[model samples]
Target: MSDNDNRGDKPQGPDNGGNGGGGSNPWMKSLLIWVGILLALAIFVTMFDGRAATTGGNTIAYSAFLDKVDEGTVKDVNISRDMISGTLSSGEKFKAYPIPDSTLVPKLRDKGVAISAKPEEGPSMLMLLLYQSLPFLLFLGIAFFVLKQMQKNSGSGAMGFGKSRAKMLTQKEGKVTFADVAGIDEAREELEEIVEFLKDPTKFARLGGKIPKGALLVGSPGTGKTLLARAIAGEAGVPFFTISGSDFVEMFVGVGASRVRDMFEQAKKSAPCIVFIDEIDAVGRHRGAGLGNGNDEREQTLNQLLVEMDGFEANEGIIIIAATNRPDVLDPALLRPGRFDRQVVVPRPDIEGRIKILEVHMKKVPLAPDVDARVIARGTPGFSGADLANLVNEAALTGARKGKRLVAMAEFEEAKDKVMMGAERRSMVMTDDEKRMTAYHEAGHAVVAMHEHASDPIHKATIIPRGRALGMVMRLPERDSYSYHRDKMYANLAVSMGGRVAEEVIFGYDKVSSGASGDIQYATGLARDMVTRWGMSDKVGPLEYGEPEGESFLGYSSSRPSRMSNATAQLIDDEIKRIVEGGLDRAKQVLSEHIDQLHTVAGALLEYETLTGDEIKKLIAGEDMDRPVPGAKVSSVPKAGTSIPKTRRPNGPFGSPTPLGA
Candidate 1:
């Protein structure tokens, strides 16, 4: 391999020179140099001043002529021996023994005085300074690098906190334009102007018109309030800022208000943008009204929101959209003409609207060729867009579970049943006797509702367990209605009482189940409303009795001092009892008249476990039941378009019923 290839394969590092500086730490190099220099200086000093002598045995005798006595040696020399003669250093001659060089050599070595014939090498002085300072220099460098990194990260960290948390989607995300939002045709008309303004704001501004400051989307939950806002963004092709009302709140006192300001600031920067706030009721609730602490953090947030919304210098290019299910609880100031200038109500889809919603959701799913969206729509009377979408998805899932490629009609039917009655409880055990009793109870409700309440016909009847009920009988209006008349109320009460009345009539006594508890409560409430609130009681003389007596000493009162006194109160109670008892009696009478048919229907329920309204009618009148009764016109059943004509007839199936006055 070439030198270039070898270099690439080998790991490399920095090189240092060999004054103990070659690949050596500066501090260690310096220490080695200093120790070498000290050793060299000690060797030179030992060479100049040498001491040498030799001895044998314990003593040595030295006889020499008297040499010149050095002044340095004569001053302190004195010798003495036991049993031998010695001389003192006062010019007196005497014999003496001296120590040996062997002992002296060890003494000199202990005092760091060694004698060597050859000299040793020593370290350099410059290497010592580098060795002493290298560790502190390396430590300072490391700390400087770490602090710089920390400062860089802290500066960049601020960018993340200031960025808006809203997720932005372009045209590629999904196609849910204004065309897909159906049912609320009127609402769509109102929002179209917004799309126009967004498309060309200068057009409206040139004519001296300002876009609406804000629009409030008010509706029940699941009614596509949020969907409409998204559609507006998609149609306008503008950046959409979406947030929930709760997002503005935080533990800090002014965090919510600060967030409101920040949100508007962001929106202003992105001019011609839509800012959608879902569930606005969280912070926009009526000011000065809330439970608990009462310091009102939500109110402060709402106040900031109001100021930002209306106090902006130039709001021509920005549009605000807010949604709330509880429009009733919002502050009046927030909804005034200048603020949420347009209030669009997105109500539950009507039948035609539901069909359109079904069409929209059915696009992606593989539905059977024979499936009819209109039929599904008719089956679902009060369904919203979200519910319809869920229905389609659920139906598709049901088909997939059955190992089918496309959703069949049967799958859709099952999904609808699941949505309406709740999931089936095959594990819900019931005794044969209990099942029979449930059948009879449900049959009683269906038969009376079908025969008496021509306006409220039986939709379906079943003895199968669903939700909390062992049996259920569904009654639906003949058509979509916005108002309920007095007769309809009385008919509803009679239907509600049918189950207990049938149990009483057939068994010659009452065997009520807790399942009828809700029914009883509903009936009782209607009776009270008739007497107290509706003034349906003749004794009460067309005066509402349930009106609240405001600002009383003992809080709100349900009753007021009447001119009729105590006896009249007694009469009112009697009238309420009479009205409720009359409903129960009428239900019993209707069930008795068709006693055999009721048993037949109940027996069928025990066999099939469920039956539709049409099926129950077949069981009631046999094959001939499809035709009207002889000499009794079906005219009492109002036609599709006409109003239910007021006529006082008999108190039987054909009677003109009246709601009990509350």
Candidate 2:
């Protein structure tokens, strides 16, 4: 946590016992206000009652008061309309209400009792008005107090719906610099010129090279677009106005436009500043794309933004930086030459980039000496900067969970499995038969992938239930691969069919479970893509076919009216079937030829519930998999005898495939 966050947790008490300037504690202030209001009401009641001053005397009945007067015991009486106050001859004070009799007054005189007549004065009209309006005034005070608090907390008052929600980011929130950014060097380089323009615009203008008025950051999610913007702000050391695109939208027609005007007005006052609008696609989407008449609140806001960005008046010294993952949906006017002139693409990091990202995140973690960034980077092919950061975090969490002092490479491996495959489901229970079937199924995939020359090396195989799968076998490339060859595609198809083929060969065809549903879906998609998209099938010709209408990643593909006609559709299906069937036959032949080795791998999985590629290779070569693995400080090596000596890859057991015909 930051120091600001920590300071908020402690009390304001100090040696002087004064309230600290950081006064977010509202309850105390509210209590004082209420206490003052209550005291004022108390004083008002005391001043209005008048009877409170005469509260010391005892109250008596009217008959007793007259009797006292008749007995000449009453001294002097202060008589009002219905009540009388007096002191007895005994010198004690009393009050009473008397009957309305004219003769009583004369009788009082005969008794020599002193009588003073004064009618009780009712409250004045002004006092009555005050009494009636007090509750309403109290209610108004409460409402005003609430509104003031709202303004203080939200910066936007209760009705400030059209105010700009942009905030000026500063170093207090931990300023981000270019040194803190990694894994996307090209994107960083693209934005460095903007920082230069902000710092010294004359250097560029001397050569008649005007800096871009706006730069649009286009990238996939988690590709570090927003982080790059922050780095630019830190480098420039100028004012930065940051707001989300959603902040410029409202239900009212002109409210969004009003906010746009306000935001630009604020930006103009702080010239030479960068205004970053993240996810600009929210308000900058295509104007006429909607089903409505096309002029909506969002379009109006977009129109105002376009005019402000590149209107008749040049916004000199002010640069606009916007980011979006869906740049395809943005309006053309927003991306035209003068508005967002330069478009920068921030792609996912490559292997080298991943290594740099890992190093950056590793500084904050206590990593073991054996933790190699290259090894983790090679294991992760398509990971973005955000993903690499999460990998490091998950590794730390795994180490903490295991009660380890430092995060080790083993913890990273487990974290990789979690991020790539899914978390392990330890709570899932399986019967003995189910466990055996899963072991055999995964063993088939591992064995087939090991025997395929073009397929990637097997990383690990497990019968442990994870994610939605009862068992899974993962493969990782020796290095990142950008393109695929025909042999590699064929190998993938064959490897995908290994699990189903194993069940058919070991058990009966009827007993083969639905465990290979995912494999079938993957194979079908690859087959169709090979025939239609990649032009791999000569029978289907080199024509591009449109997307299959109702295809899902996990479900089968369905055909509909698309770019191809009915006859061409039937031919495409034929080519897909042929490719898939060929792969099926290849997997079946390989598994049948190595039936004994398949049992050995399956038996190991049944015993260990999981096995690495190196262990599987050892098991296939008749070596003891129970021996110490690589990188372990072992005193000795285990011996093994093999009927056929084999040369295997040292780190991973792959790249040696026997020809099917041979």
Candidate 3:
């Protein structure tokens, strides 16, 4: 309680001391108003006090007064050394002042006028007191008001520096219940018991079962960890305090710790509440990972958090829920029992979960009859709930752009393409040679992917530029897969190398463009991983040689791996090069076997600019389709009005190719 609050309770009627915790403080307002009035009064008295007193009389010149005295018109008189005053027989009171002659007083006496000397007086004690003290008091009041205003505007004062900045949500505020969150059933179920504990502890307390003090939600970005926390609070219908881990950390040495203490204190007041800390890895990183001395603020904050959790009784009803993607870097103590006792892993949603997530996000969108959530879910193997939501929003935007009333399957496909391969750069102009090369390159990828035993089915092939790629071939899985086998790895590498192989087969190796640079990098990484990490290399055996990343807060580098024997290192390099060479060989053989099909697909791409998996599969199956060839002379130089194959655009409905590798 504040000191002013204590004063408010003291029987001081109508003076709440500005501390009563409700509406505006009437007593403070009244006090301020009176201060303003007193200051104004002091100013008025200060300005007007030194002037001569004026009342009920007209003043005459000294000569006129002397003449009046000679005329015997003056009856009674009062005199001072510098000025004189008198009452005339005509019943008028007047004063004549600044008289240099001393004969005036005696003359008034000779005229039979009652005369007396008026005594000199100093300013009264009230005026003197106001003059001396009112200015100081006014200055003090203005300064105090300004400081108070500054404190209010800044949301804190020097004394309140240790207060927690966590935003408090009562039961009514955060209404995001479990029904609002989908795609993470396991995480939701894990937290359901926590909510039950908050709702009523006696059921568990009778069995001597103490509620877990904390649960850490670990997941990748956009995996809905924060949303899960909010749902728990909503289900429990209790007060909720949400704060970020970075909020606790400050430049001041003990500020973070102070905030932790203050936050705990607030939780205790609103007992049975949930305190959620998002992105806890910011402040919960491993201690001593900083500079030589380590970070005092974050460490201190973590220590205080540990103490707070340890001090809480089993039935305290305060649950600390935190979320972090980098759980590996968090301090061990933070993950130990009694503090973050349960670490719930929130993984990306699988196919079914993705379908449910899409359904939930689709509630607000006007989806067309053709839009199938299941089909989209099957295509999006690694989408999180947030990603699904974004996909639906993107689809809706695509539909709106085309002036459509409903979001259709075609729009969803375009949105998915935008999400995966990136937006198509239709404005980018490609030369005739580049266009032809891109068509052959992408067709090569489609053909190789179709033949690869472990590859997913081709969805679509396009020569239209997407993102940084000159062209792209999308291969989407029918269902999500958790692991890859050796054949699958080999197939992936071969598919990655197909573009360059196609270029080498069609045009000589010298004619191949640098467009295959990304493919080579991806294939090399895969090959290296197979040799060093996956144990696919027969010479390197099943040994894992990849170094784990270091977990230092200051981003300190780790020492190199123990040096391998020269022969062993050379063997590993040779195995990686051999794997890449094998993939290139596989791609070349596949392209050579189906040279006719490759040209056919490339011709179709040059004509349509895009082909669905069904269309490509039909063409590959030897269906005689009308295929357009790039640079095929129509009449020597084509007429200006003649249709250029690459210039023809896809219909406006989708306007972009879908993600499918035929």
lDDT per residue for candidate 1 within 558-635, as digits (tens), equals 464545468767877788777876777667667656766666676677767778778777766765434332221122
Candidates arranged by lDDT, highest first: 2, 3, 1
Q: Residue 496 in model 3: shift from native, Å?
A: 0.4
> Which should have the higher TM-score, number 2 or number 3?
2
lDDT of 3 by residue, 584-646 (tens): 767766776777777778778878898988788888897644554343221222222222122
Measured on C-alpha atoms, candidate 1 has an lDDT of 0.66
Off by over 4 Å in 1: 1-169, 291-295, 312-314, 531-576, 624-662
What value does the lDDT take at residue 392 in candidate 2?
89
Candidate 3 RMSD to the correct structure: 12.0
Q: State the weakest 10-residue window (summed lDDT) of model 2.
A: 1-10
Model 3 clashes, total count: 8
Residue 601 displacement (Å), model 1: 0.7
**Which lDDT tens digits does candidate 2 get at residues 10-61?**
0111121111234456778888988988986886787668666754588999
The model with the greatest TM-score is 2
How do the predictions measure up, each by TM-score? 0.68, 0.82, 0.76
lDDT of 3: 0.76
